[model samples]
Target: MRPLTAQDPDQLGRYRLLAQIGRGGMGQVLLGQGPDGRLVAVKQIHRQFTGNPEFQARFRREVLASQQVTGAYTAGVVDHDAESATPWLASEYIAGPALQDMIAEYGKLTVSGLKLLATGLAMALLEIHRTGLVHRDLKPSNVLLTNDGPRVIDFGIARALEDDLALTQTGTVLGSPAYMSPEQAECRPLTAASDVFAVGAILAMAATGASPFEAASTPQVLYNVLYTAADTSAVPPPLRPIVEACLAKDPAARPTPEQLLDLAGRIEAEPVWPVRIRRHIADCHAEAMAWADGTARSATPQAPAPPKKRWQRLVPIAAGVSVLTLVAIAITGIGQEGTAVAMDDPPLALTDDETRGLDVCALMKPDVLGELGTAVGELVPGGVTGCRVYYLDQSGQKIYFGLETSIPVGETRSGNQPMGTTINWMPVLGRYREALSCDRSVVTQSGLPLALTMTATPNAGNGCPAAERALAAVVRRLAVNPPLRADAPDSVLRMDACTLIDIAATSAVVGDPVRERTPHGCAATGRDGYFAVDIDDRVRPDNVVGGKVRPTTTIAGREVYVHHEAETYCEFIVMIRPTRDDRAEQVHTTYYSTLPDPPDTCDTAAGLLAPALAKLPTS
Candidate 1:
């Protein structure tokens, strides 16, 4: 980003321009701050184009359509002024480099990185196409990469710039010819599939550091795009097939964005982007944060964190529930209010430290449900400290069996005590029925609080019987030495997320931060903002937490995915390692600030994660 120039306006609409982020044939993209204290990328059109009747009409229509394009991967249009003297559009300001810039500076992406890039581009296309618009110019430069994923930009105004044949200006085309499809190159009526074609070229470039249709001159490049068969030999074997299919001369031969999404799913690899690319993203984020802090544009070094402290896991503020709690709440209309637990509340039979290594999945024996039901899929990690299994009942209906170890056990003053029961001499808390669900809890011989839940499908009948049977089996197994999780000695689960970052580190963002403990993580609130750390096993950060995925940046020597929520919150997830069930053992750090802009909540989240991550096991 650069300082504003003499020609740039100090303010536009309700935004105050901060810096010139970029400039192209159409106009300039300025980093602007909205009245609500949100950052936006404001695109101001060239004065010359605003007066053109064709440009004005197309701009207005596309702007309206673009407003409807909302998805995880595309930067949705936030504000636009097509009728203004100098029409401009603003979008969520994404803090990362374009694919073109990334590839140019860092060389080609790894095969794994290419697959991630392909998936994000395909998803972005799906969103744009879903809204009845084609990203006419899907090129490396138009694709922005963030920690979460790729975001397609300029969907509306960019297309508006492609009016008459003169817009292409064969002699000086506005868009990159190398990334254009044959139909777009020939100026024929286009379809969403045309963007798919561009995705293919982009993949080829991202994989080989040069577009498949590259040439010495603009005209030559256009000729190659129109007539040449893309050379995918240099592309990685795994991605060549998809790239070839995308580069097919006939737009119809190209795979749909949905098809690409399916293909991308099969490329199962963690730490999505290449290591160097992740570092580059972190560098960009650091620079952006520096600018946000009103510091001069320069490389800012990540400061060393303070001494680590031994943090004990705190009890949940309220008695925690199983993952099935959400389903029950939806069905029973149970409210979360008046659920807080007091410090003097009854203690769990066992503490988290006593059961941290015990795998809840191990205690759930499939044969225990013999004749009554059969375990469906393999035992999978359910929550931060839990596991669950889906069993098919005799009636062919599926029942969910979830077991969470080391959660806070307590009763509210509103008579919310557990129903007394005994299984194999173990104190069992049972039969907390909620519509189609049966809930149970037990304090193990070691004194850890264990909660079990069984949720049945519609008309599946009472689940408490099977729930009790399963709990009985689990309780029985707990009597013997239970199977321990094959976690690395340095596993993140062994660390207390709440205490990961010392109070000093957390207080840097939110003054005098106070801890707000949860089942598997910790959150701190202060006068200025709130920050948190959560650990879990999941495929993607966005899947567990809803947010717009951004670029992957480096934190504490680990690659972490970044996400934003409502422009006020930011989260960074660090993937520790892949587990037995093909899920990631990841740690998530989040920040929410009331300070305007807050110097990028991402910076705060990264700072919070840095200390915690540095102390995690690396095996």
Candidate 2:
């Protein structure tokens, strides 16, 4: 949670606003304390919509429907005020990360964890459907994972905004495209089964670490949802049948909430989540409690202006770093345009040739952090090349830094007013300020952005200075003779994904293309089709269960698997070699098009993969 900004109200209705949990397209979710010291998440609609009577009516209906949903797996509506100038609804504030954040931070949930989530979600949906309302936007973000169980939030709210939020040009519905059911994608009248479809998608994500209908663009995802069979092959056997039944395109064929409960059976009483997730929940709860007790500062105090010469960056005092204030920074909502800091220095760009193979998990050692007066804790691995280090500073304040590699700087952010400055001579390509954290990324010679994020306890001051110092230390190390990955030359992590395939030849298969690239992947867009190439460690096609068998063939002495999703998309995966864990390091090339008759899209996917296989390292 973040401190309440000056522009925000100190109190709303009978509750006092303590901090902001998050903000979205509609309004903000504020952490509020009631008269009895109970905490609640207050949802305030954007003030601009106050004058719309239709919107007001819809909000009233939403409040009524939400209040009717009372169940163990759902956050109950504790209070509401629909007649207020800017209406608000206060529900039980769940002090845990969203399912989306959990999956993105930690890897896929374990089998037992998946069962817990499935049972809780099914129970929540049953309660929602019992109230004669459907959770139209039942995606991963709306589900909060707590120690007790998963609690569904924002229930019955999406149906109220459907008409106004639909994307007409793209033929997309109001809900998230990846989780939307076939009927929902087509904008047909939704029943309770639509929520079941979303549950299946969420379970798939929890089991496989990717959505069943994931795609580069929103339209492509919608098309896949409407026309393609969901890929539940990666799901474990125990829950595979349940997921498949729930994802059936025909709503009538989908199982009811009661049936899902029966299928899930009794959830084990022992720990449902892994150790990492439990630790995160404990930290979040402690922070929220600190905010409620007024022990934590609401916002970082502004630092005084620096001298006219070189702008000396002031680091935070968390780890006994210099105590001077940092260069003046105006805090604003992330992605919102703010005053840009003007600097005379040229944009900072570091050489990535030597650092390209640096192992993210080994980049920052615990001993190095301990020397800086920090008690480094567990190192949690995230994506393919990301690591999160959780630790406490000199003052015993909780903090975590997420380090990610090989991300395209363009996709991070560009021309952002607030993030236009430099940090420790590094060009700040992106800046994301949350209630109690700050994130910054810098550009590298390879054009892939290196991300270093610092999140502090609610009471702690600005963490940017400490974050900057850490990044500077990393930069200094990389500039010298830093150790690279000791893994084999053929390891996917050591190779540049773009270099494996012929871009010019692949572009011809689609059309003359405009391209955007990632550190380990290549993507191109044509008038009619979108094409991409990626390398990753995953289960071989033959091992994956419950889906239509992927046709396999040999290309250049490497095993190749062809998987098609209706006429919307096609993909071919070339298996390079098996990892120590029995997972295959594979190259995946895909083609997607929304055109009436996509020309040889699968052929294009195969065309790229076949040549890319020849370039794979034999060692």
Candidate 3:
């Protein structure tokens, strides 16, 4: 049978594929419209899995177990076909990103967020266990966070209590090692208690970034799971005991799913918990809304009109006509012909005194500052220009300090004056100053040039200056190298240190900065100056001579400014345009290597990068 691709047949029996949602080790999941146009998730197994009768039986048992489980917290399976050429299963379609993706995009969940997740997941396991099924895989990726609540997914590896064949063969183990229970890791008979332990591990991961038995390798992680106790120092006090008990090496020590649910319910009933969780959700919504608003505002060029009452709509309509007429007059470059609109409360500009009094660096604590600096340093290492650290207290206020340094511009040569360097104090402090409508600048040192400016607008409440000071002190300390660092590695050394002044100045407009993705190539004269190439070939063992041949080659070029679009594991579309330049110069080229059997949905970049390379003009 041919491998499934994006354009392959969509309707599988009664299900209509709407889109490919996600893929995993065992199968591909498609977002489909089922009977009565109800949205459902369809999981299609790979051919290899179908070839094994034991695997098919396991899959059938999972389907049976899923059918038995019913609850708002669990994604109940609606249909399945284990006897089909490529087995498939369908379940209720839950709308939301996976917990893993959400946390990766927006740090660890707050205490309230963690509590809500814990409660929802605990409730889910209660339903699963009631059906006598054990969800062997309960990692972050399997949990979906919807607006209504969390939903558990992926029952491909679930084991039913009555199934004698559920245990792995010989010395092999099933489920993710990071979240596996001690009994599960040791190949002992599984029970509902295993799911409870997995839930605790998931909650701990949500609360803290790390897992209880985090390790560099699978074997080591499994060893930690079966032999050692989890480190709970990083876990918050409220959740420490709960997660620690669940992760206890002995199965009997773990709480039942029902007990966990009760604990989560109690946490949810706390007076302050709801408010904090709501605020976190609100923040997420606001960020998303801001991004949408910005995109809409940029896409449309029209300016918004002032509001008018319904009764006075005609009058405002006439006024709008006059405004457009005036705009036309201004466009003609006859400025005096346009009417002068009256200003509503002339804007009050910030005086120099207010700017100097605005100390934004006091909002962050020393630990947060240190973590921020360390994270940035690790991200770029040799390429980092500067790093700033800051935080806001319970009351929203900025406190920060920064260290600036210059990265070597290009490869170094012996005896050559090291390439020119540039430096600036961390932007965190500067951003706060800017937020307070103040002017700030940095002086150059060690041949590293620097320049910066900031202004800030006060929110409704009074800002915290002590936090700002503490943040600044931390930044300054980080700006200097630790003692006995003369022979330290280049990575250990701080590039530069200096004190700067914040000058008082009139308030200025501080707009959000523009963010751009890495550009592949530049264009000139409206034609392609460079193009990308992609090659796909199979890997061979070192002993094999010309063992594998290239499978395919895709050569593509696009006119400059054309939008690039791609979808993973399926298909990609490249926009092309007629070359305008008479020379017919190819300015840019891109290449993509396709997956042999891409799931209905997959990441486009991962599928494209291996077989792809690009070329650009030297100039």
Which candidate number has the best TM-score?
2
Q: What ranges in model 2 sit over 4 Å off?
A: 156-173, 266-271, 298-619
Please list the C-alpha lDDT of all candidates, in the order they appear: 0.62, 0.63, 0.44
What count of clashes does model 3 give? 32
Query: Which scores greater on TM-score, model 1 or model 2?
Result: 2
lDDT of 2 by residue, 1-619 (tens): 5677655789989999998776432456788989999988887876755686756775776677678887988878888888988788888877887777677667788888888898899899888887777767676767888888888876434343244234222332335456767766555556788899999998998888778876533345557887889888889888899899999999999999999988887544342888899899898788889889887775465576432221121110010000000111111111112211101111222334434565566655552333234546777654355667866766777776766664555565552223434543445543544335655565442224444333333236776655655554454334322435565655776677767657687677657877766655777777767778776655765565676677876656666787554577888777667775647667777878757877666655666666777777652
lDDT of 1 by residue, 296-331 (tens): 454465577342211100100111100000000000
Task: Give each model a TM-score.
Answer: 0.45, 0.49, 0.44
Candidate 1 lands at a TM-score of 0.45
Query: Relative to the unseen true structure, what is the C-alpha lDDT of residue 472 in candidate 1, on a scale of 0 to 100?
Result: 59
- Candidates 1 and 2 compared: the better one by lDDT is 2
Instruction: Identify the superior model by TM-score, candidate 1 or candidate 3.
Output: 1
Q: Rank the candidates by TM-score, best first.
A: 2, 1, 3
**Models, CA RMSD each:** 29.7, 22.6, 27.4
- Model 1 has a clash total of 12
